[model samples]
Target: MTALGPEGHRKRLRERFLRSGLEGFHDHEVLELLLTFAIPRRDVKPAARALLERFQSLSAVLDATVQELTQVDGVGPHAALLLTLLPRLLERYHQDRWRTVTTLGSTRDAVRYLQGHLEAERKEIFCILALNSQNGLIAVERIQEGTVNRTAVFPRLVVEAALRHRATAVILAHNHPSGEPEPSAADRQLTRKLRRLLGDLDIAVHDHIILAGPRYYSFAERGEMD
Candidate 1:
């Protein structure tokens, strides 16, 4: 058995990852691959292990706050920023894809669009999918972030943002960290409140989607919006 030096090891690892596309890689190897993008020249194996130990999983590490990422031994400001920005980049990609569709066809279409983009989140994020008069998606805005019990979503704020965007309709969405798609009593209450508030503004609240892991709950589909 031969041990490759740092540079040689990283070069081979990169080649292997490019060929195989993360299929059979270990957790440390995956972290190492991510770090290669962030650190470039540094030996990433130890750093990757440290990050895994600190955050438990790759998703958790990517989902961590900048402060939390900074606390890890090998993660500096630049690396933490890189990790934080990756999600935003993917979000922009999703938004771009959403823009390509001429109109939202059904409740399922709306949910499917969001599920592809937001199903893996570790924290609650409230997004407003703004639509034009023809029900075409105009923009998707992340209005707030919060813990499991509470999200800082305000009906007034949502209404104001919609008016600013000149949106005729809005679809509300939030992810459940606990991975249970069932809407809580609070979720129902919030939807009703938003519905009434938006009604006054002549902006229809199309749906309130609760994303729980792979599953999703739709207020409009279940007749909860009525």
Candidate 2:
């Protein structure tokens, strides 16, 4: 009897994936399956395990920058590039999901929309979701990106963008990489400042959302917005 060749083994992995959809596979196995798309003639199990060891999780492995990924043993530039492509594609896909999101009728709706675009981010970033007079979405624009814990958000600039879009309402959002969605004192202060400043311009501050990891805090939901 002939032992299973490398091709036969890969074929089995592919068949299992097609039948069961990764439900029974380990993390390294998933990476190995993905590597088969780009790597043709090599055993990718070691490379997949090395990537997980260096990055800790499949998500982290995909989110890693090219330079960071290259530091892993058995990961060359080509493999690293393939791994990094998932995040970029996901980012674009999420952006398209919200590209025509015109009506944010509920706090949950706003939170889910924000999560689709922001949850995977590794750093702090601020954005404005501008709404028309009828609370229809006009656009979602990133205002700034900052250090891990803080972003320099200028309320005046945000107001300017809202005005440019002729927005009558705004949903403010920022992410906390600390994995706790609780709003910090600084976050609360900034929210109050923007509410007052934009209120003065006859624009409504509908909500301020603090997203940390998978959790989210909505000021409107908490009765923090008047």
User: Which one wins on lDDT?
Assistant: 2
- Which residue pairs in candidate 1 have backbone atoms (N, alpha carbon, C) closer than 3 angstroms, thus clashing? none
Candidate 1 weakest ten by summed lDDT: 1-10
My TM-score estimates for the predictions, one after another, are 0.73, 0.89
Q: What's the TM for model 1?
A: 0.73
Report how far off residue 33 is in candidate 2 (Å): 1.4
Query: What's the residue-level lDDT of 111 in candidate 1?
Result: 80
What digit string (tens of lDDT, one per residue) describes model 2 on residues 1-226?
5337657667878999999899999999988888877778688888899989988988789879989988877678888888888776776787777777778899888887887778778889999999988889888899989988889998888989988988899999999877788998888999999988889989999999989866889999899997
**lDDT by residue for model 1 (1-226), tens:** 5446767777777888889888899988877877777786778888889998988887788878899988888888888998888767776776567657767878877887786567656668888888998999887788888986568777777887898899999999998887788988888888888888888989999899888766888888888777
- Candidates in order have lDDT scores of 0.82, 0.86
Error of 2 at 179 (Å): 2.9
Q: Model 1, which residues run further than 4 Å from truth?
A: 1-3, 38-42, 65-67, 112-123, 138-148, 159-168, 177-179, 196-204, 212-215, 221-226
